[model samples]
Target: MSRTVVFIHGLWIHSVAWQPWQELFAGKGYETHAPGWPGDKDTVAETRLHSEGAGVGVDEITDSYAKFIAGLDSPPIVVGHSFGGLIAQKLLDAGLATAAVAISPAPIKGIKILPLSLLRSSFPVLSRPGNRNKVVPLTEKQFAYGFGNALPPAESAELYERIAIPSPGRPLFEASSANFTKNAPTAVDTTRAGRGPLLLLAADEDHTVPAAVVAAAYRLYASSRARTDIIKYDDRGHSAAFDHGWRQLADDSLAWLDRQSL
Candidate 1:
């Protein structure tokens, strides 16, 4: 059987957006799966219409994926975008993944640098405490600024119409206040020396999870002897994973996996 690859999507984006990635990885001789968060609808339109995932938090999302992976014949290589990136790392550390690729992953517990753009990108959920128990949808303008700032305005708008969906606010609140929270859900075991190789990708122009934030996450791995590497792309945003230029990121990921002999 072919080695498996599991793609995890982040907040505000539907799992279906990973179709192109799934096709590409499959062609490369990898079996692929992109599972949605717990309570997510089968389609983007349905998810948008009924925000059943309102109160889901990072712990719940991570656990759901863990359960999914537990049933697999073997541990798969995990790739994740935004919040999914964090989950990928967590899975890798837990020995549930053969390797991990975290693209523009949300900040883990030890990261303290919060860029103005990150705050703005999270405002849709973080501005009000009440939003913690509700699903919050981003306006087209907000999506444009947060996910597609590096793309043409028209392209950004079109992506918003196609793949965007309301996401739970609880994860944002949990990640944002992770440093102070005891047993924070956003925490990652960065110091695991025996964990699989990790590749962290960052878009220099990403408004949501800035490169600085990813750097901080990389720093948290300083104490670990595990192979942790990071790559940064110029003039790209958080949308790099699903945008027109997504192939570049995917190709690089394949190259990195080859280098690691994974």
Candidate 2:
């Protein structure tokens, strides 16, 4: 039987963000699906115009993705980025994913290390209280500082033009207030036996989810009986998966999946 891989994109970008990843995995004989979040548009331009995507929260996003995964013939290998990474972990907790990879995942409840860079990266969303119900778009300057700081200026600018989109602010607010919120949806049951093998990939220079943040998440999953590991790439930024060396990230994930025998 052929294995299936589900690619989950983070905020700002829609399912199209995973096109390259889908093709790469398809070339390796894995069937792939990249599902958009609820209210997601077909393209960045459309999403920017509509902007309702930012109103969706963690619970709604997780529930939507869980329903989609349930319809698959079998559990898929879930791979997610940023907020999608948080959703991947939630799916694994619910016994929906056979194995999982989370790249620069957003903070789940209980992760307390809020680096200065993370605060800066998230400021655009959190700065305005009303943004919880509004779409938040990143300026090129913010994108360059937060997602593409490690890339060359020209490449960073090109990437910003190609993939940047507006994101819902609610999820960021939820993540920021996770620890204080009652029954935060970002909380994961780290002790689930059937959660399966997991890998957390971090970009060493990522302004959003830095090595320290990734390490904290890995530590949370340490209690799991299933194998859990983390890999950090040097000099890469938060947008490593979409940047010039994205293939390396894909290859590393494939190699890790191979080790899991998934």
Top of the candidates by lDDT = 1
Question: What is candidate 2's TM-score against the reference?
Answer: 0.97
lDDT of 1 by residue, 1-262 (tens): 2289999999999999999989988898999999999879999999999868989999899999999998888999999999999999889988999899999999999999999999999988888999999999999999999999999999999999999999999999999999999989988888889988999999999999999999999999989999999999999999999999999999999889988865
After TM-score superposition, what is the CA distance of residue 99 in candidate 1 from its true location, in Å? 0.5
lDDT accuracy of residue 140 in candidate 1: 97
lDDT tens string, model 2, 110-184? Answer: 899999999999988888999999878899999999988999999988888888888888999999999998899
For all candidates in order, the CA lDDT equals 0.93, 0.88
List candidate 2 stretches off by more than 4 Å. none
| CA displacement after TM-score superposition, residue 108 of candidate 1 (Å) | 0.4
Worst 10 residues of 1 by lDDT: 1-10
For candidate 1, what's the RMSD? Answer: 1.1
Candidate 1 segments whose C-alpha is farther than 4 A from its true place = none
In terms of lDDT, the poorest run of 10 residues in model 2 is: 46-55
User: Model 1: how far is 4 from its true place, Å?
Assistant: 0.4
